[model samples]
Target: MDLYRNIPRKDKLLSLFNDDYAKTILNYAIDQELSNLRKLIADNKIHKIDEQLLIKNIDKRYNELISGSLKRVVNATGIVLHTNLGRAPLSEDFIHNIKDIVSRYSNLEYDLEKGVRGERYHHVVEYLKIITNCEDALVVNNNAAAVFLINNTFNKGKKVIISRGELVEIGGSFRIPEVIANSGAILKEVGTTNKTKISDYENAIDEDTTMIIKIHKSNYAIIGFTDEVPYREIPKIAQKFGLLSYCDLGSGSIIPGIGCNEPTLSEIYNYGYDLVSCSGDKLFGSVQAGIIIGKKKLIEKLKKNQLLRMLRVDKITLSLLQETLKAYLTDSYNNIRSVNLLGTPLTDLLKKAKKLKRILNRHLSDYFDFETKEITSYTGGGSCPMHEIKSYAVICKSKKIDINKIENFLRKYHIPVIIRLVDNKIVLDVRTIFEDEFVLIKDALVWATNQLS
Candidate 1:
């Protein structure tokens, strides 16, 4: 048939997707072929072009493009927890545990006590309760989910009072108001954007006020002539109205230091937030999950909520979070890659950058200008939005090579290296890049030199 003639003689494409799968590919392939066929008809080359050959060629191209890996260029760009680069890199130990749990039959919901069905969240529940010193705890897929679960459980059909300044729009336009609305909680603005006081909440109090929520401005800071309420003062206010005080500590930090006055989960609970929700990924440096920790009475109510089971984390998340919490409990801060990077000293980072520069210069000395300079690295992924840590970078100037082109090529390479540009020169910040990635950077520089010359 004329249509059969358009199929190309490519065995690779033929074998890759068999009849059923190939049929799906063929529809789009044929649509693409239709455009080419139209051109052939217009050029009077319809008879010269084999119809089957055309289909096969298009299918070959389609097959080549369809792969499982979600490959994309990462211009690390000096953002430490670059959210696009999968936020924090999973620690080696965490990665191993993930593989072991995911690959086999885990005790995700199988209770060994009576050989009965178990709860998936039980994996991290005890750890969170112990570490945070909370009476009970729960976890979900992400912080947003945790917030929703808490609100739906406690504050539904009631008012959730929050400072206007604290109502932030998280990454991807996930605004605080929107989340509260979705959770069936009415967002009652308490005070001015930058200056909210205790009186604001006191005046806004009403019978419908089910909870007084304090949303931590974790990602950013409101400074200069700013007056805010503290956790210590909040419990009294909530107690006055018999309202549950919940704190959504987005990007909650466990490790202290670096000037952010944000309290840890334990601190918040101690200071008197009845319930607190934080992210597992951001400051905790674990997988993408939401951790809700608070009083047992409230948590037990949340646990009994049907929506809790719907938004509960899977076995893999449970396992990774459980192990990640253990690392926190043991004070093995190094086990969490993001926390470790944040805690590294400026002197140590400069020394490492100097070492990386020396290794790279040994290979590309003649090709590029190499110099180590002091820079500031961010605790990105919306963790420490306003804080900047002093860091060092090996700034390289490529001779006659297009800076953008060089950057594009480097980004396209396997296991891409993210670099920054200073004064039109390519700069690699060693703060975010670990010691092991140093050799990889050196190799990439060598490859870039080859591309230039």
Candidate 2:
């Protein structure tokens, strides 16, 4: 029989699509099952139909479909602010703080004192002001929204003079020029790519210029003979022309130890910036959001602007951000996960690596090469581009299964183990991995070795 003739039609495969099979996997689309069954029929013959195997395949497909693609993976990359694995995992205790808040209704927008509607940002603004010493503060969905609000609220159809060197591309391909242009503002880039002076900004200012903006190159660094004006210098020039001054601290820095040289929010405010914007998920170690703090008048303009309504944060985001901010006011070292993870001392990491080595070497020694070595982790999420987090990694390699095979096998485990492969070796950075999760790592490696053998 011809190959196409052997393939079953929908009506022909009705037995499998009946009440038991179809209803069992109602969560998953049957179309995929049809495609796979048809291919199987074509590969074999009509007489070779495997009902039991088909049902087994259906069960596997159903499990994959029900468990959404975004399954939680263990971050062994050692990057504290890993962008892919949900940058800055909130501390379990901090999440517990907001569980009751999210479980029931609270005064999100209602003012209990006067029996009137209150502002959503009122939840975090006072805390933000207290921390940064800003006159006023507001919260948006993310830092990009804060940047867009600045441009849309103040510089619509007007010019925003910025240094060419400071024109940065944030994560997910969102560029500075694109954000400004999309916000209904004009981008008047000044200075050269490697050099921009206070005079460069001063020279670009004209009657059309509404603000002088500076963007932190959060993800990249340029060294050797590069000249840039102080963050304070740009706003000083803007003040001379009666213009607003804003700085988008891309991966918002509140802690000094996380990203080595990134300026703190308080330090940036002290530098005379009229408005400062930051992301909550980055170094703030909270939810994904933009925090804007500045003079009361400027913030009021953003709050009252119609654009704010479009870019405003929801109740849950506001609540989570409020709790995350509370972490900073208290003991940030104990509260924030990224702060503790990134700030994990080299001595501590060495201790962890030794402990991991003892566990893994006992089980994985036969199948793989196990050695403890000093490794470098990054401050990911485009915060500290090439800066290294000195740490220790259990460097693993197998003679039977290559690094690619090891990586693929580890991913198939119940809790996916994400490891970094550098220098033709499988590196498991133990900084981000919890001590409790070590059992899963052991099981995965054992299973992988058995399968390969």
Candidate 3:
């Protein structure tokens, strides 16, 4: 009758698990499971405890404790640069090629030519300069860090004139005004939120104004009688007054005709901005980095800033970014996974979807119906909000089982299949799903059907 005594001892429960897990972890799982069982007994939720059920619960707990939160999942949502799914997915082949360099020590900072300590930013700066046609370049942890470094370096304790319409907030509550304030630069907002002209920036500039920054509204668009000074015009205003000019091309792009009216890096540079910064992981399609490219003298000054050390990236990031830049320089767009996905032709996507549908139907015909559907995909990660890419998705429907249940099962599977439900149907957009991941999707479908059946 006493349910407390029904709980097994720690050692007995621990013996059920293997030595693959640490003793402490095993003990913790057992203790937590037993504690839960005790709570259930206290709540009078059950008359008695089942030994098998208790063992099963402990086993589940042990697995949960040992499992890592960062597991690879199939990105079936069709968002090429899904921020939640780790902005940009690096190429496995590329990572494999650079494994020796990243895994082992190889002159990350040592200058092989001069046989002396060298700058880490030097590795990718040349490539960036060539690709972007900039005088110099620097890489920090992310775009926000690049912006922070620029603010702290030049505009700290000075006024930074920016258009109110361009004051943008990106993912994770990263607001422009907050970043400037945190960097010790005073923010001077000019013009209305929906409309700001060149005069707004000109009037806001004073002796205290050290710089004028034009930020790209990457995530959203302002419509209906909107007037803002073009980025190209800012440098002229700054030149006339002998002040610094910078533009935050949030989710900056190098590839022209990438759509969504996103200006290329070269175009921005030609506009005569003194400094420019963008995200490496977004439209750039590399590792996560804040890429700052501008005049050589200004870049040198940024390198000397003490905060650069804190914002600097590791060798792995540099290596990945360098490889991505090489791909761009050589016109090897296929090597860049994000670029390839974004540029995948509609015909190719339809073929991929058809192949995937055949594979799924061959295995899972009884429980579900599979068909290809044309859908819209986005260049997510705040790069282009209005632009939509034509994509193909495998729509799955079931009559015997609830559609939501199937979706939940796929999501909770060992290898989660991140999917979307469209009008009570499961949608798997093949735009973001790699060909190699087809097997995983098939397996996930099989696993879901088996569990649901």
Candidate 4:
């Protein structure tokens, strides 16, 4: 008690916040840290934290304040589109191309030929047209922004009929009805959660009806006795009534079978949708952006919307999305991390699991048990929740470390290995684990188990 009472004043503690840390964090961080140290002394179990220990603790606090809030971690969890690990990994080409854009000032809004103000979306529009076969294209900050802009543009103060089954909220609690309502659009949900027919949509239509929306349930699935109108059918009925039809292809799949198995943009456009929107990051394997493809007149209308200016994608997003589309046009999509990973064969995944198991055995034979187990890897990022890629994983059972400790040990590495605890065992799925990252996993295992060995 005397030791804790004799502790330095709060001002003395605040003084320890040096130039290494931001000015804002100095006082609060120092007070919190010193308060903890004092509590330890008050408890008397920690003995007495000497002046040297206090100084050292404050330095640690400084490091914590300055450290980046985000970390680069290895995805051993088998969720390829792991949302937390920054979703899709960029291809080497995108990275290489982005260097020049990041390093130098770009003609982001400058027309080189016209010597005048140009649209930033021009960088990606031509490629989007080529790939999607749409009359025109537009991009915005995110899919929500795209949806908000679309609904707000045409359907505000008007009725937009949508299926009850398709009223989905993605990862961030961004709900369809909420977005529609916020855009000042009236949402007229028809039919039941499991069955919504084209007739139901047709019945909802009147003078107030401006657009019919089909939201593809990307993140979840409701199986058994579920019947809903096809995306083509809704748009067909909309066209009959002279109403606009839009499809929110949530996964934004470009490749037919690669991601989520959602219909491609070309398929949607060719099916006669007036407007279709999708995500650039989810299935496109690029940075986060929303791509809208449809009739030229509709896109031009979107461009003219005042909301377009507020929701426009920046130069970096344009450059990355443009390069990603180019890769698709050139048939170099296999070079993309997400595409290649999703396209990996089950046989290849099994081989990777076995190889990783063998490597772990060789390095950590004494302290752990390494075995290959049959597992199913998820096509994550709210793309295809029901669709799974059956694969194999390496399960590690440590002789000394508990299951949670094993995970913590991996996290202690310079590049942490994020694993999954399945059936009371730690699993490392090699589906997203490329050939190069294997060695790092091995090294992490060795370092983590060194004490036990």
Candidate 5:
């Protein structure tokens, strides 16, 4: 103590041990440093570490170990198909299929009939082409990859015509111009941001133009005094120039009702687009995938691209997606979770609201004012931005707690009840909630009431 007392704080701390203890501490510290250093090296981000910052670096590693890893959380934010919450939840049928294939090595690349090696894409290709009535089809990891493959294979170093209005930036700060740039294709902007005429596309066409690309504004819409060239018109323009007509229907929906603006895959195929690309997990309600369908020649070219191999779907994605496609093929539409949620009637929603009210009343009648009222639920997941389906919900009245606090409390409950703060009370919309989720709703309410007490 006397030997260390006169030393400065920094030097004393670094030298608080004898030679043997110092060697052991330094070795352990070196091991810890090397553990982190190895990770940086693996990530190709390695750099020189400062010895002076060793203590601060150690603190970061200790903090990471204690942090919660990815775990299931209740979606009480009212954003169904919330991107952060893994987008769309897989249907039971799809989940079972995935488990079965993953548990045992099924015929992932082996053909049962031919008794030989088969392509993995054969699983979903026929179904996708049949469902969309396209000449050929392909699947990739995501819609972005689909676009990249299509552009890179077909229009690399060539001009791609697009409307300025439809060049939208969806979630994740991803922009259309950026994707075009990344594909090594020249983006020939046709018209103004809100208005683009067919003539603008016609004038933009030249010897350098290889394709006419139409992008759907999945997340936003321009209403009132907006003018844009219809998708059908572009196919003719492409035909005139002997170029391909490609529509990147970002959020493709097959089951259409209740005011959805998404154009179906069949609709685009019928109208005469040579190629169509869309996301599987958005309106189609499948696992994350990119489904591209089009002319046989063009699709064959895309399949031959070297990049296609890199962006190909895995065994799990193909297995689950095959089951999801079967669900669509069957007449039973309720098997699809997103479709069922979209098609749920107000009367059905009201019944759920009443049941929820009864459950809440059993726990705490004094805490809330319960009433079934008309409400609107959006077809989220960027399918229909302007459309809101009319629904019913149970509005809770709370005098002691503010609407935000009630919502926060319900959200933090074990089952996590997503409630809307309506007219200063926590409102429960039954449209998005599943009929089977009643038990969860009851438990969440019970938990919330206990919190208040």
Candidate 6:
């Protein structure tokens, strides 16, 4: 069979892609496509190959190779702090403010006032101290790194006590016990899964005990008939035993009046713990960082640890976090995108939903019926598992087209519009959708209708 001959040469395929795509990538794409075609031929999966169709496939492969996987997508799912879609959305203003620092050279580690070498963490530490009112603060790559660094630094080769109920498994199968054990610390589980009293922690302490860690169950809740020692008590017990007390407030809340059950950073600070750690991306509404704020002496010890060099954040993270803290210091919560989205009033969301419904009706009415419906949103990213945010969504139903088809089309659009399905109807929550995205949403819906027709 001339099926193999029908497959064009790599050089021939390269000529088809005359765009700005890299030559190496184009060649790699051609090789991959040719290899797949050969395998199909050997397996008898393909009987014949059309030369023109082969060119088209090769062109498609080249474009796919050059186009990166990370893309900007519209979040219509109503989950504000969506972990999969890049945890927290940084404010445009924050990004704009840091453009100069990231794009050009600046005193990232140099102190201009002293005209000498300085520390990178200092840039944000002052801001954090001002906002959090902690004696000292440190920022790591992520919250997990912060926890591991703390454990490795303070409790290495020693026993660390934590309640069995508080041994949480965060996203991506990262468990608390595993992190502790891997950090050269022995994890001592205390009390039952549903209840752990202050006495449990005290009893667990022995000659090997070095610290008591209080892990916040940020992702899930164990409700009803539960008895747990107050967080403030853990610090007291540790002090009596001459041990360190640290709290991992997984999704650390810095902003007040957000209406979540999680305690704020200030309240946690006043809990008398030697150190406190929380995620910068979660309720903090900043970039992905591990924030450790505590006694100056303890923080100084963490800074001296060799692991600090590895887990330290880059200048970009420091700048972004600095701007976010500045927003907090100025009491401009609205400037933070995540906080703004979380604080959006129900009536405002309803108005936006109604406006979207009318827009969809005017354009897609012939194919689908559009109406506004009340729905519940979430502060996703493993924070406030039991809290439900009342929101509004635009529900679409079609008599001719399949709901799944519309969803698939919108998801694959150039600017993907992520949506949810409720009662077999396509729903788009306006809480997470921005006003500037309205045009994009309408265009995606219209494109979906065209494809379905």
Which candidate gets the maximum TM-score versus the true structure?
6
For each candidate, the alpha-carbon lDDT, in order, equals 0.78, 0.83, 0.89, 0.85, 0.77, 0.89
Residue pairs clashing, model 2: 142-289, 142-290, 143-290
Over 1-453, each residue of candidate 5 has an lDDT whose tens digit, in order, gives 232232224344346334544454454554575566556656756355444465555444444344434545554334555676777677786676578688888898898999999888889888887788888888999998988889999889999999988888878998888988899999999899889998898898899999999998887889888998887888998998898899999777776552375678888877899999999888888889999988999988998999988999988899888888888888556667766766676677778778877876776677776787887766666677867678777777875655676677776664556566756877677766666676777677666766766
Could you tell which candidate, 3 or 6, scores higher by lDDT? 6
Clashing pairs in 5: 76-418, 369-397
User: What is residue 360's positional error in candidate 5, in angstroms?
Assistant: 0.9
Flag regions of model 4 displaced more than 4 Å.
2-5, 9-32, 35-54, 450-453
lDDT of model 3, residue 443: 94
Query: What's the CA error at residue 204 for candidate 6, in Å?
Result: 0.6
Estimated TM-score for each candidate: 0.86, 0.93, 0.94, 0.92, 0.82, 0.97
Name the top lDDT candidate.
Answer: 6
Using lDDT as the yardstick, the better of models 1 and 3 is 3
- Regions of candidate 2 where Cα sits further than 4 Å from its true position: 2-28, 35-54
Model 1 TM: 0.86
- Cα lDDT, model 5, residue 49: 42
Is candidate 2 or 5 superior in TM-score? 2
- Error of model 4, residue 201, in angstroms: 0.8
lDDT comparison, 2 vs 6, better candidate: 6
Task: Name the better of 4 and 6 by TM-score.
Answer: 6
Q: What local lDDT does model 5 show for residue 231?
A: 77
- 3 against 4, candidate with superior TM-score: 3
For residues 1-453, what per-residue lDDT tens digits would candidate 6 score against the true structure? 768887777777777777687888778877887898899999999898867777777778877776776899999999999998998899989988999999999898898999999999888889878877899999999999999999999999999999999999988999999999999999999999999998898888999999999998978888898999888898999999999999999888887667377888878888898999999998999999999999999999999999999999998999999999999889888888898899999999999998888887888888888888898878999888889989999988886888899899998899899999988898899999998898899999999989989
